[model samples]
Target: MLMFATNDQLLKNAIDDLGKYVDLKDLGEPRYILGIQVNHDKKEQKIKREQKITLNQRKQIDDILKTFHMEDCKAVKTPMDVSQWKQSLARATESKQATNCPDVPYQSLMGHLMYLVQGTRPDIAFATNYRLWW
Candidate 1:
């Protein structure tokens, strides 16, 4: 669907001109497009677009948590825990078994987190990118 913002007269004229070349159906003002919510204020002559996760994105995160058995995990106040990272790094360097650790779905979870970071969660991008390095 095509959506354009303009004055009433101009929109009518454009629609009339385009109707000659192609069929057109007015779906009226759009409240949502793609994954973004659209808010229009006619009195202020302003429009705002907000990015929000759809039902599919919610299900994706839910599935990821379920796969890892982390559905009931407690939420942390911060995205990155520096103390935990330090302990993990220390353990990795001291233990030979760290080199032979089993494979994990880190790449898949990173991909999902990256999508969230690129969309509406810029706050987690730094932590996500830091994890990518290791």
Candidate 2:
């Protein structure tokens, strides 16, 4: 679960204090947890990096869905046109402008799609990353 604390000291103290109630001995300090990574660098302030997904990460998917905005979009068994979709770096490059062709909502949808790819949807990684190229 994502957690937010008022300050660094509070977070540190919490982690230290958690040792008393939760045994984290079985888990390693996560290098990458969920779509975010926890890193420590004395030289830099803490930053949350999105390990997967990129800008315009799923424009095609969202653009298509948006066209059906008023229509019902039930969760489907698949995320894309599985039978016809093919991964092509060249195609993605050529289609970059088209993918980035929309506005704020499309952009937001792209971000959400990227988060989805980072979370539990590994199957969409290729397509999502492909979208990133665009």
The prediction achieving the highest TM-score against the true structure is 1
TM-scores for every predicted model? 0.53, 0.34
Clashing residue pairs in candidate 2, if any? Answer: none
Per-residue error (Å), model 1, residue 38:
8.8
In order, what lDDT does every prediction score?
A: 0.66, 0.55
Clashing pairs in 1: none
lDDT of 2 by residue, 1-134 (tens): 33446666786687778878876453433445543445545334424431222233244456556664724677634455645456444555677756575664655556766776765567777667656554
Error of 2 at 33 (Å): 12
Worst 10 residues of 1 by lDDT: 47-56
Of the candidates shown, which would achieve the greatest lDDT relative to the real structure?
A: 1
